[model samples]
Target: MKVKRYVVDDLPQAVQMIRSELGSDAVILNTKEIRTGGFLGMFRKKRVEVIAAIDEASRKPAPRPAAPTKPIVRKSEPSEESAIPAVQLPNAAVRERYARSTGTSDAPAVRTSAVPSAASAVAVAVPAESPSKEAPERGAFAVPDDPRPARPVQAGAGLAENPDTASLLTELRSMKEMMVKLSKQQTFRSMPDSVMNWSRRLAEQGVEAPIIERFAEEVNDRLGTEGADDESAALSVAREVLLEWLLPSAGSGINSSTRIVHFVGPTGVGKTTTIAKIAADQSLTHHRTVGLITSDTYRIAAVDQLRTYADILNLPLEVVFSPSEAQRAFKKFEDRDLVLMDTAGRNYRNELLVSEVNSMLSPGEHAETILVLSMTQKYGDMKSVASQFAKYGVTRLLLTKVDETDSYGSILNLALEYSFAISYITCGQTVPDDIRPFDPNEWVSRLLGEPAYA
Candidate 1:
């Protein structure tokens, strides 16, 4: 492979130089902005410097063969008028065909009348042409006047003088552009294969590309500085970066000062189920005075689901419709140590619905709003859902369905995007048993492709 660099005024000039020197089979390695002809770097002109390389063995075209010589003819007798009989030369079409088939130019054509059977000689000379007969002249088989209109040739067609050359150039230019784009994207999207293996692992776990890119870069940068060449060392750095970004913490356990905790988010995110789990944990496990208040009147069985859990726990359940009713319920549960309120699940896309729920939960300083999200939902959709519910002054995040997915990147993504702390993660449908408080080290270890340290 031959490598060369061209610093030109613009990309087009660099491309032309590469094409002229390297032909269309060159691969672009790298490109960068360069400044030249400057006085103390004040008056420099900007230019693009391209680094291109081509394999000599592959790019070089094969050499052409020497043309065949004409045979010498001798006069048979004085009666023979001419040494060679009057015969027509083969047309341009036949010459081109012979050249293509033999992969060589300058092959001499024999006179038509010199051989008694001209067609038979042609069949013997070029056996490949036997399957398809030669095409007739354009006007030979045409009816009286041609009806098809002539195509107008283009004017001042730059870099398109020859159709074949233009096609090659266009294809080369397209390839160069794609390579350049991919090269640029690699700065943000790609990493060395050693580190990239972890990036793919993260992606397979359902982590978003941008987050994986960041982790890979951090790992690579750390490895570069420390001169740690081992793959395990790079993975350690990745794990550290993810742990720092995750910011996981155990949920602020129910305390005396904490009076009301309201759960709010989009539809079917297990808001009621989550509340039931927490209620069970507080009432049965923690042995605290726990009560339930719900405004989830949308679903057909939301109220009944909560009622069943409330009956099992043997705690007072308050069903409210409006903010006033919620306030009244808060007053009813004032004596309790902890009150878990479940709000109606509505599409957070509607501003009015979020605002209404926000108002319902915005009762007093003791009230803490926690936005519940499902792990099964995409990070992008989670971002949208979080943005809408952010107006609720979300204090913490409660992620549901952790057992349903392999990836935990969405947890870190939402934490960074919304700046909301994760309090708990519910993994299964079993009340109290499925829920676990967020543990920083354990979550990070699991996310970075290690078994949970917990």
Candidate 2:
């Protein structure tokens, strides 16, 4: 079977990639997406990784079924309570006919015996049990030894006179003893209950089964290693992953001396809201004099949203409906320590939208474009947003609606694949507090498939 893995933003593209590489007989094994690169995986976009394998078993024909097994019996014991065993010869006489000769009297010695043949012993021992815990069938796994058929026998005697039967019983005891020792060294396993769920999650995101199996093995080996050093190492890796975000607190292409930073993203991604929050942070927390400008003419309430935030903070609001208007607005706030522009959300897939966003801050301006992306967007859609907006001169990325999604695996692959810096993440609808600066370590912890805590 040919098993392969791929990471993309969309399911159709992912499936197409798989079919192009492997044939139609391929069976999907798993899918998973881990965030990577930077700017909350703004670089690689949202990735959906898929793993598939071929089914070789179906290529050949089926085989015929086999028959079932039954049981048998052999001989009996002289005394069931006797501890010492008796040794009997094969084809021997049924009983020693004493002509009033040497026979023990006082208290007759107890004689323990087994079936005269191994075949009968196997049958009787197996069939006697009902194949249950408490009760069993008749003579199941009970056969012991077999006696010679051609021997002359006494009237009332059983098959205990067979010497060969006695020898066969001795060999069975030795084999059973060996089997007991071997069973102790082997490992026992039960089927897992959540295999399908785990597999489905991985399959949906495009992670290969082989990698998951390897991780499972490692987790088993390190199940109980919760030392200080291990904790520290895990935290360190997490921090680094979180650092991949380009939140303004993490620093980006612009220096602190720059006065203008712009926010851009798809419609309804809270770009204007996030920009106002950042501006408020600068004015209240950092004590930096900040100004706000809105260039969102495509939607009716887009400017209204920014206007309300500006009104609450007593901050100046400039509405720019075109590129020329944006340039004039920049000139008006040229002296401010920080000027945050809220551009109309630009669909990265729309060529005209990406072009318009790029033109506003591309020439004769100190503005740094910050791309605001949604965390809830599917991986492929996220990628499309990133790819389209890249040409719009977005200097860093801002991720909104962080608390709404459960899986953050797409972030890892994005950071690893792209170098975009993440500026901030918003976990709630509130201003300021909901929007916090990005921390690589903290983000990586979240990206590592855990809540944002040590």
Q: All candidates' TM-scores?
A: 0.58, 0.48
Q: What lDDT is reached at residue 285 by model 2?
A: 85
* lDDT tens per residue, model 2, 107-189: 22223334433334211112222233332222122323333334554763543567777678778889998886555323112
* Model 1 CA RMSD to the hidden true structure, in angstroms: 24.6
- Per-residue lDDT of 1-454 in model 1, one digit per residue for the tens? 8999999888888888999989999888999998889888699999889999999999667975432233323333334233332222345554565567566675444222212231332211222212122332221111111122344546846357768888998899999999987885776454566677777777876677777767777888887844445787877777778777776434665555878998999998999999989988888887789989999898898899999999998989999999898889888887899999999888887888888888888467777888899998988788888888776567588999988887787877776667787888889999889998887777777766675432
Query: Distance (Å) between predicted and true CA of 150, model 2?
Result: 95
lDDT of each: 0.74, 0.60
lDDT of 2 at 41: 40
* Top model number, lDDT: 1
What does the lDDT read for residue 310 in candidate 2? 91
